[model samples]
Target: MRDPDAFYPGSRTREEWLAECAFDQACGGATITPGGAPLPGTEQAEQQPAEPAPAPAAPDPTTATIEDVAEFAPDPPQVVGEPDGIGVVGMPTNFVVDATEHTVTGDIFDIPVTVRFTPVSYVFDYGDGTRRETTSPGTSWQDLDVPQFTATDTSHSYGEPGEYEVGVTIRYAAEADAGGGWFPIAGLLELTAPTTVIRIVDVDTALVERTCAEDPSGPGC
Candidate 1:
C-alpha cells in the first residue's frame, strides 16, 4: 500500500531495483524504513557489500549510426579483389580439415587493392570454384577495423561435421559494365571464373590455446 521506492534505499526505479537489489536479501524485506531506520531485521542491510555491475558489451551491429559512404576518403585500402572484383586468384576455394576451435587465418588476395566504394554487394569465390554473394550488403565501416569497407560474404560455421567449399563474388555499384554493357566488369574481373578450394572436413578440437611445452622425446620436434 506504500510506495515501493520508499522502501528501497539505494534506488528509485523498478528497473534499477530489479537489476541491483531484487536478488539481494540483506534489506530484510523492509517495505519501508521510517526516518532511515530499519523497519525490522535490517542489520544485514548495513553489512552487505554493494554488488559489482556487469561489464559493458562490445559494439552492437544494429541501430548504430554510420557514414553513408566514403566519398573522397583519404588513403583508402588497396583492394586486390578478383582482378575486376569477380572472385579472385588464390583464395581458400577449398576447405581443409582443422579443429573447430582453431581460428582460421589466411590471406586470399593477390594484393591489397582499392575500390570506388560504390557497390551494392560482393561475392567471394572460394578457391575450390564455388561462389557466394552477400545478397544485399549495406555499405558501412562501423562493423570492421578497416575503413571504407563492405561485406562481401561471411564464413560458414560447421554446425555439425561435414566437408565444404567456399567462394564469393562482389557485385559492383555500376548497373552496367564499361561502354554501357550489362556484362562489362564481370569479364574484367572474370566473373564467370569463380576461384577454387578443395573440400575440408571439420574435426574435433582439443586445445585451442597452447603453452610452451617440449616433446618428451627431444628438445623440439
Candidate 2:
C-alpha cells in the first residue's frame, strides 16, 4: 500500500526552507481547499441545461418539396401571338411566351424560406382542339429572319376560319433557400395565362387589270 503521508501534501515530510518558500509563494497567503468540488456559483453555471442542443437546427432547404412553396409559385407566363388577334386559314400563325425567374419569401414549417420559380417548359393550346408542348418559347417571324405565315415549330395552320381562344400553360421548377445556398425542390408547378382571342379569315384572290397600288380602288384590293 502507498504511504498515506506520501499522498497527503500536509503530512508529507518537507524541509524547513521548502515549507517556508511554499508558505510565502502559494495561494496568495489564502487558505486552499482541494478536491473536485466546484467553486461557489460555478455548479449552477455548469448545469445550465446545455442550451437545448441549438434547437435541432431548422430543416435543410434541400428537404423542401414543391408543395412547400406552392403558395408562392410564380404567375403564369405572358402569351403573345403573331398577327395580333388574327390569322388566315391554311396559313401558319406563330406564338411566343415570356417568363422570368422570381423569388418569394414565406414561412415553411415555421422556418423562414425564400423560394425561386423558373420557367422550364411551355404548353400551348391553340384552341382548335389541339395542344402542343415545346421547350422553345416561339419567336416571331421577324426575329427568325423568316417571312410571316411561314410554318415554324410553334406555328399552326388553321383548318377552318372562326374565332378561337388561344391559351398557354407554363411549367415552373422551384428551388428553396433557407439562409443557405439554393437547392432544387422536387416536381414542377404549372400555371395558365389568360386566353387570347384570335379571328381567322379566309382570303380570296382574283385577276385584276391593274394592281391595287396603281389604282386606289382596283379589283381585289
Candidate 3:
C-alpha cells in the first residue's frame, strides 16, 4: 500500500490519526486541524476534563435587606371607624384596622424569595393635628363588649365639630426566606393605609317630660 502521509499535504502517521479521533471523542466532538492540532476552542476542551456544568453558578447569596423587600409589602386595609365614618364631637370615636400578617413571594436577584410582613405598630392621624401611636389596632365597641362612642385604645376625641380625614400608618417587621429558613431583616417598613373621612357633628341635650315617641313636638325633641 502507498504511504497515506504522501497523499496528505503534511506528514501524518496512522497512529496520529487514531490519536486525533480519540482526542475528538474525549473533547466531545472537537474537530482536528492540519498537523493534528485541535481547533482553537477545542484545544482546551480536549486537554481539560469535562468541567462539571460550572456548578450551577451558585445562588446570588447576598442577603436581602428590609428596603429590598419593601416594594412587595402591601398597605394595610384602611383604618376602619367604628361608626363607619361618622363620629360625635367630644365622644371617643373608636378605630380599628386589619393588621393581619401576610406573606409575599417573588424573585430577588433571580432567586426565589419569600417575604413575611407583620404589623408591629400603628400610628393614627386624627387629622386635627393630633396623632397617636399604639401597639394595638384596637377593636370596635361591639367587639370590645362596650357601647358605641366609648373610649378605646384607638379612639380619638375631636375638640370641635368638623369633617376630618383620618389616616393610619402601619409599621411592619419583615423576614425573608430564600430557600433557606426564614431570617429577619433589620428595620421596619411603614405602610400608609388609605385615609378615611369621618364626619364629626355637634349635638345638644335637653330634658323633656316625654319621649319623642310620646310627643313629637316636645321641648328640644
Among all candidates shown, the one with the greatest TM-score: 3
lDDT at position 106, candidate 2: 89
| Clash-forming residue pairs, model 2 | none
- Between candidates 1 and 3, the one scoring higher on lDDT is 3
Deviation (Å) of 5 in candidate 2? 62
Candidate 3 lDDT tens digits, 29-59 = 2122224323335433324467554333243
* lDDT per residue (tens digit) for residues 153-179 in model 1: 443322333333343343222111111
**Pairs clashing within candidate 3:** none
**lDDT score of residue 146 within candidate 3:** 89
Model 3 backbone overlap count: 0
Q: Which candidate do you rate higher for TM-score, 2 or 3?
A: 3
- Which is the winner by lDDT between candidate 2 and candidate 3? 3
* Per-residue lDDT value at 211 in model 1: 34
Model 2 C-alpha lDDT per residue in residues 84-136, reported as the tens digit of each score: 76889999989887777779998877778888776666789999999997767
The segments of candidate 3 whose C-alpha lies over 4 angstroms from its true place after superposition are 1-62
Per-model TM-score on C-alpha atoms:
0.24, 0.69, 0.70
- Every candidate's lDDT: 0.27, 0.67, 0.68
CA error at residue 204 for candidate 2, angstroms: 1.2
